[model samples]
Target: MTVDWDWSYTGDILPDLLKGLRYTIIATLAGYAIAIVLGMVWTLLRRTPFAAVNQAVRWITEFIRSTPLLVQLFFLYNVLPSWGLSLSSLTTGIIGLGLHYSTYTAEVYRAGIADVPRGQWEAATALNLPRSRVWLDVILPQAVRRVIPTLGNYLIAMFKDSPLLLAINVAELLHEAFEVGSKSLMFLEPITLVGLLFVAVSVPSSILVRRLERRYATY
Candidate 1:
């Protein structure tokens, strides 16, 4: 009595599964957006001349990178309430994802910044360019171009990690699949669909990142 696949049963649950997929996509986009901005800020702070500021940023980034993302998500969603700061599950997931990944992305940004030519800095200094204008117009533009591939890779990583939002009850794709499969006792089809959906997206995204790398080749 081993019934493997049922097309009609899968069809019945497609809508609910799609709803979860939508939430997963939204959370990934929101979280990545925040992570990009926060990571850039951290990278810029790391460049500050003050030793204390640099050390503080380094220590904090290390602390975040060392921690498990699941624990961080729980702390933000559950424990923050005790400190008079509460967030919705989706918002908590977004912030938690942002903070966790920003630590890694900051290092990517730092590497990009380091790749900028020393001559460019010297030229800016010779031209009497304002510090802000030099950094804004010259450095970041070049650095961003160099780092797009790295950042895109992080985007894919963040997309995959979005399922962890289930810890905060965000109802992302895998969580939704689990819910439906649990009730119907048909885990195979729903879970298979989830894997297919992830593969369908991730493969194309990885290809796009590779193209971006070629586009920005050092040569």
Candidate 2:
């Protein structure tokens, strides 16, 4: 069988794909925001004086990192509503993506925080700086800056992973592509376009991340 490519069909499906891409972008940004903040929380919790708290947080982070994201997504999608906390598919997807990646981000944060010189903490202690002030003003500023490029890489990964939300019916880019192709009985155009669109976003993002790595190399 011969395959024919139709530019007009591609144009016709562009808007729907763009709509799905919008959801994909939104989910990625929201999820990544949560990951960054929650990951820091996990890192800080692990550093707490209470050994129990540290161990518990460490175990939780390990468990999350060890599990598959899709499994977590399904669990949240199914379990939450039964507990009277039903979330929209998109919201659930965001939360799943965030929670899964938070474990990875926490490791990144731990590395960045560890790289902060011991003298920095000693100096803060000598000044009698409040713990909160030391973390917020001295530690986090450095740690976050160092991890920004790595986090940007995760953002791109999360964007690519957004299509997995279709498993829970979130209607992201790949879902839209599937629908268009299924209805039109033509998979090539929609699938190829979806791939190109992914490249369109991720390539520029990767370039920016490389620039950030260079600009912050001295930090």
Candidate 3:
């Protein structure tokens, strides 16, 4: 079937799409913030000297990373309410995106931490620095900087995946586009606008990530 392109229709729906874009950006930032902190915690938690706790954390991170994010979202949005853990749609989406992606971030942080020189740890210990001081004042500064590009890439990914919040009724960009299309009885303009909007953001962000990765690689 041939579908006509309507520039006028697109212009009319632009405002609605922009509103959704705002929410998309907000969700991405919030989710990425959660991922950043939780990811670091996960990486550090697994390094505990306690074997049982360390093993349990490793298993949990692996489980979270291996599972599909959509399934996690569904469980958080639908199943949890049944267990008396009801959460609003936006809350669920933020938590779901944060947690699901945090496993990957943890791995990135792990790689970053591994990149730190072993001698640095020895020096810190020899100086009688607390482990927390070693990590905060020395190790993490280098590790987190090295992983900036990777984390930025994930933020772009989470921005794209913000559409999945539709499953739980959080009206992000894709959901907004769908709603506009349904109301106007014209899917082409709204859907195409959504695509264009995603490209507009993702392409530049990807370029930035590449630049960051190259800059970090030099160091």
Candidate that would win on TM-score: 1
RMSD of each: 1.7, 1.7, 2.0
Tens-digit per-residue lDDT, 84-189, candidate 1: 9877899999999999999989999999989999999999999999989998998889988999999999999999999999988999999999999999999999
Which regions in candidate 2 have their CA more than 4 angstroms from the true location? 1-3, 125-133
Q: Is candidate 1 or candidate 3 better by lDDT?
A: 1
Ranking by TM-score: 1, 2, 3
Residues 1-219, candidate 3: write the lDDT tens digits.
987988888888889889888888888889999998999899889888999989999999999999888999998998889999978899899999999889989999999899898998899999999878998998988887888998899999999898998888887899899999999799988988899889999999999999999888726
Off-target runs (Cα >4 Å) in candidate 3 are 1-3, 123-133
Q: Which of the two candidates, 2 or 3, achieves a greater lDDT against the reference?
A: 2
lDDT of each: 0.93, 0.93, 0.90
RMSD of candidate 1 to the truth, in angstroms, is 1.7
Q: Could you tell me the lDDT of residue 204 within candidate 3?
A: 94
Q: List the residue pairs that clash in candidate 1.
A: none
| Cα lDDT tens digits for candidate 2, 1-219 | 987999999999999999999999999999999998999899989988999999999999999999889999999999999999988999999999999999999999999989888999999999999989999999888887888899889999999888999999998999999999999899999999999999999999999999999988744
Colliding pairs, model 2 = none
